[model samples]
Target: MASLAALLREAGHQVSGSDEGVYPPMSHFLADRGIPVQQGYHPRNLDPVPDLVVIGNALSRGNPEIEWVLNRRIPYTSFPEALKRFFLRGKVPVVVAGTHGKTTTTSMLSWGMEVAGLRPDFLIGGIAENFRSSYGKGGGDHFVVEGDEYDSAFFDKGPKFLHYLPYLAVIGNLEYDHADIYPDLESIKLQFRRLVHLIPTEGFLAVGGESPAALEACAGSLCARETFGLDPGCDWNADGIEMTEGRTCFDVTYRGKAFGRFRMQVVGHYNIRNALAATAVLHRLGVSARDIGRGLESFAGVRRRLQLRAEVGGIRIYEDFAHHPTAVSGTLETVRAAFRPERVWAVYEPRSATSRRNVFQLEIADALAKADCVAIPALFRPDKVPEGERLDLDRLVADLGRRGVAAWNLETVDAIIEKVVAEARPGDLVVLLSNGGFGGIYDKLPAALAGRTETTPGG
Candidate 1:
C-alpha cells in the first residue's frame, strides 16, 4: 500500500493514510516521500474528506475511517481497482500471480525490462533492493505488477489479480494458501483459472510446469501458453544447475533447444523457477537472451526473501518471509545447500492467518524437520483463532522429535532469542521465518547474540 501511495503521490495526488501500526522501511519510505501518516484510524482522519478513499483489504466495515466513508457515501475503491483505473489502463500489464515467488519474479521481470532499455513501470509487493523501492514509473509500454490472489477488500470478495487486465500473466506456482479466505486448494485454483481467462488472445500465459494445479488452472486459455520449470518436459526449462558461493548458474532450454546459460545471485530451486518464469516473460516481450542474462546477473533480489540481517559471533542470522509449507521447505533447503557443513536453525513464527490455523500443521512440521534444530514461537494473535482451529505447537514439536529433529516450542521472542544465542555456534546459520514482524526478533536477536558473545569464554 505504501508503494501505491508513493505512485499516487508521484502522479500528483494529495494522499494521506491511517493505520493501527506503521513501521519502517514503509514508514520511512512514506516519510521520505513527504507523506504524512496518521498513527491510527479515526473518523476525524477523514474530516477533510479526500476525493477518493483507497481501502486496503486489511480494513473492514467497522474501521472508523471506513465507517466515515460509508456514512458519508464518499467515493471509495479497493487498491486493485484504484491501480487499474489510475495506472494500469492502456498499458501492457504484466501481472505476476502465484502462491510463491510473485514479488521476486515481478522484481526480476521489471528489472529485466528496465535493463533492456524498456524503462517499464512496475509496482511490486516487496521492496526491490535493486530499485530501492517497490514502485517505478517508466516511459515503456509495459507495467509489471505483483498480482495477489488474496481478496481485494471487504466489499470486493474477488481476488485482487482479477482486477488487473493482464496482457501477459505469469503464474509462478499454485498451492492452498490464504486459509482465512480460501477453503481449499480447489477454491484457490478457481481464482487462478479466472485470472487465466482474463488474458487476451494476443497475450501470453506462462505457468510453472511442476505444479499440476497451475497447469490445470491454465486449461482452456485462449492466449498463448508456455510452461517453465526445472523439469525437462517444460517448454522453457533450466538444467545443469550449480550453486556456489551464494550464486546459482544454470542453462536454459527453450522448446528443446539451448536458449542460453544464465546466472542469478539468488539461491534455491524455487528461485531458479522464478527466474525461469521471468526469463520466459522477457523472451516473449522480445528481450534478447544477452540482456536477460545480464539482468538476471545484476539483480540484487527483494528484501526479506532470504536476506542476511546480521553476523554475530561468526553466526549468520537471516530473515525470510516464508510462512507457507512450500516456502518454508524451499528456503531451508536453499540455506542447507548453500551453506553446507553449517547447522541451519529454523526459527518460525506462525503469524499469518493461514499459518495460525491447523490447516498446514503437518506440512509445516515436515518442512521444519529438514533443519538441524527448529524453534517455534507462540502464534501471533492466537486469540483470533478458535481454540480448536489454532495450530498445536506441542504436537508439532513432538512430530519433529519423532523425525529425529531437535525442536522447541518457545512461547515468546525473548525465549527463542535466548535459546538461539546459547545454542548457536560459530558458522551456524539462523533463518528466521515469518510473514509479519516476529516481535521485531530480527533486531532483538542480533543484539542479544552480540551481548552474549561479550561475556562468553572467548572474552
Candidate 2:
C-alpha cells in the first residue's frame, strides 16, 4: 500500500494515506517521497476526498476510512486493479508469483533487467537495494511486479496476481499459505492454475522443479513451461553449490547444456532457486549469461530477509520476515550454511494470518528445531484467532524440547531481548523472525548488547 503511494505520487496525483500504524522502512520510504500519512484512520482523514482510494487487502469495511468511502460513494479500487488500470495495461509484466520468494525474485528480475539495460519499471514488496525503492516508473516496456497470491481487497477476495496480466510469470514454489483466506492446499493451487492459464501461448512460466504442487498448478499451461531448482532433473539446474566467506557459488545448466557459472552474495537453497527462476526468465528475454552473472553477483538482498542488524560482543543479530514454517526453515538453512560453526538462534513471532493458526503448528515446531536454540514471543494478535485455532505456545516449546532443541515462549519482546542478550555468547547467530517489527527489537537488542562499545552495526 505504501508502494502504491509512491507509484501514485510518481503519476502526479496528490496522495495521502491513513494507517493504524506505519513504521520504517516503509514509513521512511513514504516520508522520503513527501507522501503525507495520517497515523490513524478516521473519516476526517478522508476530508478533501481524493479522486480514488486504493484500499489494501488489510483494510476491511469496518475501517473508518473504508466506511467513509462507502457512505459517500467515493470511487475506490483494490491495489492490483489500480496497477492494471493505471500502470500495467500497455507494459510487458513479468509477474513473480508464489507462496515464497516473490519479493526477492521480483527484485532480482528487476535488477537483472536494469543491468541488461532494459530499464524495466518494477514494484517489489520490499525495498530493492539496486533501485533504492520498492517502485519505479521506467521508460522501458517491461513492468516487473511481485504478484502476491494474497487477496486484492476486502471487497475483492480474488488473488492479486489475476490483475497483473502476466505476460511471463514465475511460480517459484507453492504451498498452502494465508490460512485465514484459503481453506486448503488445493484451494490455493486452483488460484495458481488460473494464473498459468492466463498466460499467452507466446509467454512462458518458470516454476520450481522440486515443488510438485507448483508443477501440478502449471500442468498443461498454454505458455511454455520451464523448471528451475537445485534438482539436477530441472530444466534450469544449479549444480555444485557452495556457500563460503559470505558468497554462494554455483554452476547453472539449462536443459542439460551448461549455461554459465554464477556466484551471488545471497545464501541458502531457496535463494539459489529464486536466482534460478529470475535467470531463466532473463535468459528467455535475451539477457546474456555474463550479464546475468554480473547482475546477480552485485545484487544486495531485500530488506528484512536475512538483514544482519548488528554484531555486538561477537553476537550477530539478524532480522527476517519469516512467519511461515517453510520460510523459517529456509532462512535458518541460509544462515547455517553461510555462517558455519556459529550457534544459531531462531526467534519467531507467529504473526502472519497463517502462522497465528494451528494449521501449521507442528510444522512450525519442526522448522524452528533446526536452530540450536529458539525463542518465540506470544503470537501477534492472539485475540483475533479463536483460542481453539491459535498456535499453542506450550506445545511448541515442549515439542522443541523433545527434539533436544532448547526453546522458550518468552511471551513479550522485551523479555526476549533481556534473556537472549544476557546469555548470548560471541559468534552466536541470533535471528529474530517476524512479519511485524518484533516491538522494535532491532534497536533494543543491539543497544543492550552494545554496552561494551566494541560492537559494530551492519547494514
Candidate 3:
C-alpha cells in the first residue's frame, strides 16, 4: 500500500492516509515521500472529502474511515482495483502468484528486466535491495507485480490477483495457508484457478512441476504453460546444485539441453525454483540467457527473508518472515546447509492468524523439528483464537521431545532470549521466525547477545 501511495504521489495525486499503527521502514518511506499519514483512523480524517478513497484489505466495514465512506456514498476502490485502473491497464503485467516466493520471484524478474535494459515498472510487497524501493515507474511496456492471494477489501472479497490482468504468470508453489480467509486447500487452489483463467491465450503460465497444487491450478488454463522445478520432467530444471560459503551455484537445463550455469548470493532450493520461475518468464519474453545470468548474479535479494541480522562471538542471529510450516522448514534447511557444523536454534513466533490455529499443528511440529533446537513464543494475541482452535504449544513441545529434538514453549521474548544466550555456544546459528514484528526481537536479541559476550570472562 505504501508503494502504491508512493507511485500515486509520483504521478501527482494528493494522497493522505490514516492507520491504527505505523512503523518503519514504511512509516519512514512514506514520510520521505512527503505522504501525510494520520496516527490512527477516525471519521474526521475524511472530513475534507477527497476525490477518491483507496481501501486496504486490512480495514473492514466497521472501520471509522470505511464507515464514513460508505455512509456518504463517496467513490472508493480497493488497492488492486486502483492499481489496475491507474498503472496496469495497458501494460503487460507479469504477475508472480503463490503462497510463498512471490516477492522474491517478482524482484528477480524486475531486476532481470532492468539488466536486459527493459526498464520495466514493478510493485513488490517487500523492499528489493537492488532497486532500494518496492516500486518503480519505468518507461518499458512490462510491469512486474507481486500478486497476493489475500482478499481485496471489504467491498471486494475476491483474491487481489484477479485484478491484475497478467500477460504472464508464475505459480512457484502452493500449500494451504491464510486459514482465516481460506477454508481449505481446495478453496485456495480455486482462487489460483481463477487467476489462471484470466491469462490471455497468447500469454503463458510458468508453474512449479513438483507442486501438485500448482500443476492442478494450471490444468484448466487456456494459455500455454511451462513447468520449472528440480524434477526432470519440468520444461526448465536445475541440476548440479552446490552451496558453499554463503553462495548457491547450479546448472539450469531447458528440455534436456544445458541453458547456463547460474550462481546467486541467496541460499535455498526454493529460491532456486524462484529463480527458475523468473528465468522461464524472462526467457519466454525474449530475454537472453546472458542477461538473466547477470541479473541473477547482481540481485541483492528482498528484506526480511532469511536476512542475517548480527553475528556475535561466532553465534549468528538471522531473521525471516516465515509464518507457514513449509517456509519455516525451507529457511531452517538452508541455514543448516549453508553454515555446516553449526547447530541451529529455531525461535518461532506463532503470530499469523493461521499459525495461531491448530490447522497446521502437525506440520509445524515436523518443520521445526528439523532444527537442532526449537523455541516457540506464545501466540502474539491469544484472544483472537478460541481455546479449542488455538495451537497447542504443550503438545508440540512434547511431540518434538518424543522425536529426540530439544524444544521449548517460552512465552515472552525475554525468556526466549535468555534461553538462547545460555544454551547457544560458539558456532551456533539462531534464526528468528515470525510474520509480525515479534516484539522487535530482531534488534533486542543481538544486543542481549552482545551484552552476554562482554560479561563472559576470558581471563
Candidate 4:
C-alpha cells in the first residue's frame, strides 16, 4: 500500500488512506511521500473521496469507509484491478508465483533486473531491503511482480494473480495453504492452473522440480515450461550448494551448459532454491548470470523474513512473518543452517485466519518442534473462530512436550516475554514468528529481555 502511495505521489496524484493502526516503516514511508493517513476508519473519510477507491482485501463489508462508498455509489476497484488497468497492462510483466518464496524470489529477480540495467517496474508483498520499498517503477521495459494467490478483494473472490496477465510466470513451488478460502490442495491447485492457462504460448513458465503440486498445477498447460531446483532432472539445477557464515553459495547449470556460480548474503538452503528460481527467470529474460550473481550477492533480504530486530548481551533476536506450517519449518531450517547457536528459542503466534483454526494444529505443533524451546501466545481474538474450530493451546503444548521439546503457552505478550527472559541464556538465538505484528512482540521482547539482564541494551 505504501508503494502504491509512493507511486501515485511520484505521478503527482493526491493520495490519502485510513487504517486501524498504521505504524512504521509504512507510516514513515507514507509521510515521506506527503500522503495523509486517517487513523481509524470513519465514514467521513469517503466524503471528499477523489478519483477511485482501491479497496484492500482486508477491508470487508462492514468497514465504515467501504459502507459509505457503497451508500454514496462511489467508483471503486480492487488494488489488483487498479494495477492491471493503470500500471501493469502493456508492460512486460514477469510474475513470480507460488505458495511460498514469492517475496524473496521476486526481490531477487527485480534486483537482478535493476543491476542488469533493466530497471523494471516491480511490486512485491514485503519491503525489499535492496529497494527499501514494496513497489518500484523503473525506466525499463520489463516489470517484475510478486504474484500472490490471496483473493484480490471481498467481492472479487478470485486469486490475486489471475489479473496480472503475466507474460512470464515462475512457479517457485506449491503447497496447500490459506485453509479459509481454499478447501483442499486441489482447490489451491486450480488457482495455479488458472494462472498457468493465462500465460501466452510465447511466455515462459519456470517451475520447481520434484514438486508434485507444481507438476499437477502445470499439467496440460500450453505455455512453454522450464523446470528449476535441486532435482537432477530439472532443466535448471543447483549443484555444490554450501552455506557459510549465514550465506549461501551454489552453482546453477541450465541444460548441459554452465549457467554460472552464484552466492547470496541471505541464509537458507531454501534461499538457494529461491535464487535458482530468480536466476532462471532473469536468464530467460536476457539477464546475464554475472549480473544475477552481483544482484544476489548484494541483496540484504526482505523486510519480515529473518529480520534482525536487535541483539543484546551476545543474544541475537529475529522477527519473521512465518505463519504457515511449511514457512515456519523452512524458516527454522534456514535459521538452524545459518546460525549455529547454543540454544534456539522459537515464539509463535497463531494469528492468521488459518492458524487460529484447529485444521493446522498438528502441522503447527510438528513445525514448532524443530526449535529447542517453543512458545505459543494465546490466540489473538479467539472468539473470531467458532468454539470448536479455534486452536487448542493445551494440545499443542502437550504434543511438543511429547516430542521432548520445551513448550510454553502464554496468554499475553508480557507473559511470553517473562517466560523467554527466564529460559533464554546467553548465546541463544531467539526467533519470534507471526504474520501480523504479534502485538509488536518483536519490539517488546528486546525491551523485556534487556531489562531482565545485567547487560547492554540491544537485540
TM-scores of all models?
0.98, 0.96, 0.98, 0.95
lDDT of 4 by residue, 299-392 (tens): 9899988988988767899998898888999888778877888887889999888888988889989899999999888897888788898989
> Candidate 2 — what's its lDDT?
0.89
lDDT of 1 by residue, 76-141 (tens): 999999999999998999999999999999999999999999999999989899998889998789
- lDDT at 244 for candidate 1? 64
What are the Cα lDDT values of the candidates?
Answer: 0.92, 0.89, 0.92, 0.86
Regions more than 4 Å wrong, model 3: none
Error of 1 at 445 (Å): 1.3
In model 4, which residue pairs have backbone atoms overlapping below 3 Å?
Answer: 310-459, 311-459, 312-459
Off by over 4 Å in 4: 455-459
Q: Which ten residues in a row have the lowest lDDT in candidate 1?
A: 333-342
For candidate 4, report its TM-score.
Answer: 0.95
Candidate 1: regions farther than 4 A off: none
In each prediction, how many residue pairs overlap at the backbone (N, C-alpha, C within less than 3 A)?
0, 0, 0, 3
Location of the lowest summed lDDT over 10 successive residues in candidate 3:
333-342
lDDT of 1: 0.92
lDDT of 2 by residue, 1-459 (tens): 888778888899898988877877668888988898989888899889889988988888688888889989999999999999989999999999998999999999999999999999899999887787888877898999999888889989999999999999999988999888899999999999999989999998999999999999999798888999999999999988889746999999999999999999878888889999999999999999999999999999898888889887778989999888999998888888888746899988888888999999899998999999998898898898988999999999999999999889899888888778767788889998998867888899899888644444541
